[model samples]
Target chain A: MRVTVVGLGPGAGRDLTGRAREALEQAELIIGYTAYIELIREEFSHKEMRSTGMRKEVDRCRAAVEEAVAGKDVAMVCSGDSGIYGMAALVYEVAQEYPPIEIEVVPGITAACGGAAVLGAPLTHDFAVVSLSDLLTPWEKIERRLICAAQADFVLCLYNPASHSRPDHLRRACDILLAAGKAPDTVCGFVQNIGREGECAVLTTLAALRDTKVDMFTTVFIGSGQTRVLNGKMVTPRGYLQREN
Target chain B: MRVTVVGLGPGAGRDLTGRAREALEQAELIIGYTAYIELIREEFSHKEMRSTGMRKEVDRCRAAVEEAVAGKDVAMVCSGDSGIYGMAALVYEVAQEYPPIEIEVVPGITAACGGAAVLGAPLTHDFAVVSLSDLLTPWEKIERRLICAAQADFVLCLYNPASHSRPDHLRRACDILLAAGKAPDTVCGFVQNIGREGECAVLTTLAALRDTKVDMFTTVFIGSGQTRVLNGKMVTPRGYLQREN
Candidate 1:
């Protein structure tokens, strides 16, 4: 049995890598979250797909492993790179029980890269990615990371910044950055819907981002202290070129 | 006239995104480093190709912009994501002198994403990427990032780990991690020539990584305290589902 964990990239089929497309073509069973499964179904309509609702990641992963262990080629799909906040880890943990299966995690264009492209070169320097979901990790830990990254002057990519259950997470994260001494005028931006339809990018400042309306599908980028808006594009220069002579 | 900054992905043609391929196909002239120009020559042979040696980034980007402003469709190619340590920023900086040209930055598979796939889900949690090459960036800043990331427990993806001129950079980086209280047995790994020929991945510990031989094309991954070696795979669990019952 062989199970392939495929990252579908942001949301566009054009962003899908050849390896991911090949994995889907080779699979006898496809499993994923409802939205992700739906997104890929148009192109992979002939495949057998099983999708579940949110928060059922454990159950979904177990099912994929069960199908793979039963001598079927399985492809588990996730948005962005499977290794980053995707389903790769849960799939591996579930597959441990049903051993003797070959598993390969195919990388994809994560939200940070996809979003950065839409907003310009906001990630051209050393950066950190933190999830503000606060469901699995303690809020205190997330706050600490935000403050540390801010103080270190690292560009930050914040994932899961806002959802229906937690609308004020972005504001709190911005507060932490502000308290860490980041300038209110520091360049910042957000890409909502990423590569999917209705995609839009906003180039703003850290102070403005505090009250920016965002949701689960939004990917927020907080620039480093040296970030700038040149020709209306936000860019964080690579340290070498930005350093004084 | 349009100038598309294309990211050729790590190395393999299949890793290239559709949008990047489209930009190349639409381009009448392509500009890039000698090695990268050679890599894409077979597919884009008909286009007028201009290649240059290393350490001439400013010169190369200026030529591409000049061609674009002269009413030619141009593509400036770089390995990995064009925005991440690639040519997007350079292209933007140069194109600034000649405004009114459409420039699009097409993202690609960066080393962190491409190499992480081969080494399992080592980047499942918050992470940081620090380039070990001090040619452009001073060693002090690199050392500071390594220490801060270690103290914050951010899984680190180290780029440009070693070159002929600086073979001991990786070792010194590991020493800093060790001094920052990271366990000597903390999971660590590297991928050489990721997504291309001669690609190899290693699963080891921080102590062992100190002596590992690496080169300019290598990408090193340093696992956090929560990272573990399971079934020969390096994995850092996402905090949400990793809480103890």
Candidate 2:
């Protein structure tokens, strides 16, 4: 038996890819974190559900792998793309203890993509995706990433910028970028609850975003030096109009 | 009328999201580069299609915006996520000359995510995406990005690593990564024509990848300091089993 690891996009419904949808439909059991499971419960109501609470990722992956080992086709779902800050890596780690079972990773639209669309096209060139939550990684590494991305002039897509555990992480990251040479007026944006109810995207400057309050559900974007605000939208051109190719 | 910018997701069929598929079905005219249009030609055979040659991006966006201005519902397609190094920003730029017209950017699976799955989970942690092609951006900028991302220990996903025009670009990039402190034995991989007919993924050392031949369609991934090869699949752990979160 095989366990199909699927990405459920940022939220639900229309963002799900045809292949991911088919994988979910074919699975005999659905498994994910409690909150992510609830997002798809209405659509996959007929399937058996298994979920674990926050910070219980090991349990969730182990349970999913054991289910697959017991001859059940399983779908281990995650919010956004499964491979990026999602459960795919953990699942692989946990699956190492079980008997040989195939694992398939179905890519989905991650917050970087979903959030970028909502705020226009802030990632139209080279970019960096950094998460500011220091729960797993040390704060120093996170600060280093922010500094390097800013120094390289990469458009930045930041995940977990702020959460209950650390409300000032975004603020610190902004300061790091500023010190690393990112301009104060650099275009930035954030999309909260992307592809879900109450979804909203706000465009602002890096200096302004430093003081903005956002929760865990928000995805933040900081533009490169070439980024600009056009028609009330965030856009970073790849210099196509300068047109030399 | 509206011009919907849709990402075709790497290649055809199963990778297309429900909303993107719906947008294409509802559009009166589908526009894209001649190559990307052919990727979906068989599936959307019944629809009217308009495709431009390579380097004619401005022309393609102009036509799409003009078609939407003429009251036709249009879908302008890009090979990967439209907001990332794709046509959405250009569409918005071109639309600036026309009367106010609604534009919707529907996200899709980008190459970084799709190729990461094929290679097993090289991007499990924070990462940087840099395109080696200096077609639009200067080569010096690309070099600086590679250096900075390496110095920061960010997992890297490289796009357009090589092409006929720049056959040695990937080699040059590998040298730059090494000079920036990335170990020569660091795990690296690439996926060619991801999700397409002859798709293939191979894992190698950074030194080995330096010598590998890849075309424009390939997406290359370089692991972070903590990344390793697990069970023949690349995995970068976020320290979940190390259990500190």
Candidate 3:
């Protein structure tokens, strides 16, 4: 009767919100990217699953819309929040081509939040979420965002920092941050695999992060000018205690 | 044994992830701001609850840490994601002076994500999250962040957009954005009381939003250059359908 676009959080079962789990549990069919499907394939073993390979976003969404239009209750899952770099917008866009159907978006914890927890609180203040993937956006635009975010001293959460086609993108982003008046020693961190196995988090300077190689599964964080490393954890104070003085 | 910082995800029980609920249910005491405590007090009526009034973040977190250090498992709840403008960082900062007690941050659906879901997929691309309140952070710093975020065309999710002391902040920010070359017709939206009683979502333009006064309870979304309104919903495309050509 309706299509629910669900965000499954970063990874692992515990991160899934109550509503997201309930939607997935009640859905007659679940659809998403092949890798995202693999995340919950075991949890919802009884439900019918449909998936498509990478770069097949449009087709995947169309299939979901078609199924929903045919009276099948569907849940299209995405990693992180379904509304952030996920399938929620595409579903709304695709659903326009079909009969009217209710579309509900179930929000989940995105990488910025999940990774921030593992690396301490680098996003307690104002921040920007940028993706280095140039497959869809131009590198020049990405460069500008890095510069602005750095110049303004906003904590930066970089997504899709590296990929096969853009293996050097993380380095390039780091360079942009460095060039945009950000100090080379700015506290930075990256988390790999998030809640899933092999999940790892490391803290380093902006200079060191440039040399560190990470895969597509990694999420990177660059601290603001006010950020600091205390007790080996990177944290950007919200300026509450300081004002208490 | 540990202090679990949980994000309540807007203001609804359905928005609480399974992990967050479990933490609250298992905790011996739940602590947070007075309003946030009231949000989940009914759901976990069996648990002991403690809260502090506004601007008492330090006292509140210190209390939570004291409770945990005394061997009672405690959960500190925040309205949105505990990491973003939440108490996760403050807890880590306060725990430094005391004995090393386990500090775990359970990520929840932040306002940006929860508000985006109600307003449609306006944050499907990269964005910046900025808070207008300058109670702790100076006003000048907030001004620069607004200018830079607007110049870079990053979709902006604004928190605490207006308050009694800063009633003109949102309008002032819009003036800066307009001065920074953002179009007056730029798509914008705001959601009040997200996921709670009297919840309302409105779609407009930057020009209109500047005049639409909002309280701290509202989360405002300003679209990037690529954002649009389709079928009465605001959406910022990830450039998928366009790239298919």
Every model's TM-score on chain B: 0.96, 0.98, 0.98
CAPRI band for model 1 = medium
CA shift of A73, model 1, Å: 0.7
Complex DockQ, candidate 1: 0.66
TM-score of chain B of 1: 0.96
True contacts kept of each: 0.56, 0.80, 0.81
Clashing pairs in 3: A17-B17, A18-B17, A18-B18
lDDT of 1 by residue, A120-153 (tens): 8888878999999988888998888887787668
Q: For candidate 2, give the lDDT of residue B126.
A: 97
Weakest 10 consecutive residues, lDDT, candidate 2 chain A? A236-245
DockQ (CA atoms), all models: 0.66, 0.87, 0.83
**Segments of candidate 2 deviating more than 4 angstroms:** none
Query: Could you tell which candidate, 1 or 2, scores higher by TM-score?
Result: 2
Report clash pairs, candidate 1.
A136-B240
Worst 10 residues of 1 chain B by lDDT: B236-245
Report iRMS values in order.
Answer: 1.6, 0.7, 0.9
Native contact fraction (fnat) of model 2: 0.80
Query: What is the TM-score ranking, best to worst?
Result: 2, 3, 1
Candidate 3 wrong stretches, greater than 4 Å? none
